[model samples]
Target: MDSISQLPDALLLGVLSLLPAKDVVATMILSKRWQFLWMFVPKLIYDDNYQNIEFERLSRFVYRSLLLHEAPVIETLHFIIRPKSNVVDIGVWTRTAVKRCVRELIIEMDCSSSSTAPVMLPRSLYSGCSILVKLKLKKVVLVDVTSPFSFPSLKELSLKSVKYPDEEFVQSLLSNCPVLESLVVKQCPNDNATIFTVKNSSLKSLVLENQDLRYNDIGAGYVIDAPSLEKFKIRDLHEDRFCVIENEMPNIVEADIDVAYGHPGKILSSITSVKHLTLCITSSKDAYPVGLAFCSLVYLEIWTLDTEWSNDLNLLMCVLRDSPNLRALKLEQLDCDGDRSCWMEPSSAPECVIWSLETLELVDYEGAEEEKKVIAFILRNANCLKKATISTESTDPNKRLEMLKELELFPRRSPNCQLAFYYSP
Candidate 1:
């Protein structure tokens, strides 16, 4: 009884459709022609870790494995259940995987530390799947569905820890997902999606995470226009919310602005055609007004959470004097305000440190003396610099050799500049 069990039967159901639907129903005890061959296995995954089971014996083993799944065409149906799972057995396993035509439907019914009751997303999966192309939901609950919501070949959507019944029912479920294109909204500790309007034009990658504005109610906000966006991310949106930008996104390149406590409002001049920007804030009102022209900036990242090092080095010298084609710079100092005092250099210099800066990175470096005078004013004015990396938070040994001999006596003006240091624990 070998010869690889006499392969065939569509090459053993394509190797049991790469297992895991309880290991392809435990190969039905490998006999009787592998018994019903896991009913033509076609990718049916049920990730169960239901914390100490017994939900009626896991809903009678998912109703006898969907009555021995016959698989006509269900490309992928990943259901992650737990936390009191059993909304009528997830509406009879999402109406039997949308009547066997599912094409990527990932459901995460986490119930968030259950008290059960919160699993209503089975209106025949919005009109019996018109070939769904990817939908991901978490913590489930999206009622108020009226019909006419046709997905028409959806294209990647993710709503984490969801619970919508308003905000125009999440803007009529994102204007009926007509050709969606990668979207992710993560908020849930019983999140109630407060006014998150995204005007998708076949969207192009967006991610908005965590919204808990002390239970917003007085002028809540969040809005985007998505003129065919090109990757955007926003986090926290600290308090006085009212962030709206229902237009202007001339095909953004890449942005990851984090607003944890203040100012990030005008959507940072509507992502002036961003080119890899990441600015985390705590205040310094997100300085960016050197006539706001990041004309397709080139990689700049600065994060500051517990400020005061002269307001994150004056917001990193006003985002390197407004990113004039910035080449590469990453500076991060989340917290450590003993205020050792120093940063008083920028009285000019900074057109990307005198001509398209070239790669510099400092993270959590606390040589203080204002981070060794901002790394000796970027190795004495970048001049098309070529690689400077410091990583210290000084675990003293004479303070990391007095910050590598005070930044190697800073003079450098890039004749192929190069310097390095480490020690971040």
Candidate 2:
């Protein structure tokens, strides 16, 4: 026998641990010794994105594999099953994994069909899986818990396309995770719950992404009250009524907010302590709250949907004025359509614009009169500026050259500043 085939049982099992559950089971054909070596592997991953195999055969194979595995404590159990999979088999498989003391469980189920009801996890998962440290479920329905439950060891929990029984169940689920530090929820319009309030003190990172705003004035909202949160991100693709940040996060280091239409103040006010911030706002008029100061901000990126750039010009000026210690600035125009007739300079330049700003980046630069004026204004005032990069959407070589010439003629306040241009074809 070869040296590899003659390896020790423990080493052989270690090799098999990296293979998918299907491939591990196929090792039965290699040799008698290799047949049961895979049974001792600690991690089992099953993915049913195959084309030739029939669903009935796949189901039987999964059940047989689970029954034959000889591992004492399963470290990881992952299943990526299609929506057409049998719910009863999934439940049985999950129960078996829980019985074997699974430490990490991930289930990604496709629910695009919408014809099948969301799969209900076994109750044993909540009450019995004491060793679980990470749990991620997609397109699963979480039923209301009648009895008390807690995941004492869970540290990471992600629910995407998940349907909750009610608002109370979600609260109960989060409250039970004593050590959970990272939580992610990507909810859709059909998720049934219009409002989700996360109020965990132990959470450090939170992400809330809501898609497909049903109506222009849908009364959807989120309430976050995590005091220890350090990284926060929220994206509402369409219009929502409002978002409430009940507690001011003192330890927030990073925040990324994108709201198509809503009260922008609720988001800006919550991240005053953040060092890195990205704001993507789309409103008919400027909506940023006044007197907000980003005392800790060092990097700032702004994306506006105003075609004229005048709708949010005042808000932009306020942000520049508030971030006195900012070192980098990035501006991108989302919907560049109208003329530059609406552009007007602020009464006075911000302190950061004159002294602290070092790097400036502009995207979707169309070489309009207002864009030229803004570029000139920054180059003429920013004494500490080191580099400025401008990327335009125009593909024509002649237009790019013309825009570059126009920008090069603008006077520079800092002799050390370098200019760079990029053209998107």
Compared with the true structure, model 2 gives a TM-score of: 0.92
lDDT of 2 at 316: 76
Worst ten in a row by lDDT for model 2: 211-220
TM-score, each model? Answer: 0.33, 0.92
Give the number of the best model, judged by lDDT: 2
Cα lDDT of all candidates, in order? Answer: 0.77, 0.83
How do the residues 91-199 of candidate 1 rate in per-residue lDDT, one tens digit apiece? 8888877877888889886554646556787677888888889989887887776667678898998998688877777777777887898999876644566667877
Off by over 4 Å in 2: 1-18, 111-116, 215-218, 284-286, 339-341
Task: Give one digit per residue, the lDDT tens place, for model 2 in 201-295.
Answer: 99999998886555333566788899999999988877655688898899999999888755678788888999999888877365788788998
Task: Supply every candidate's count of residue pairs whose N, Cα or C atoms clash at under 3 angstroms.
Answer: 0, 0
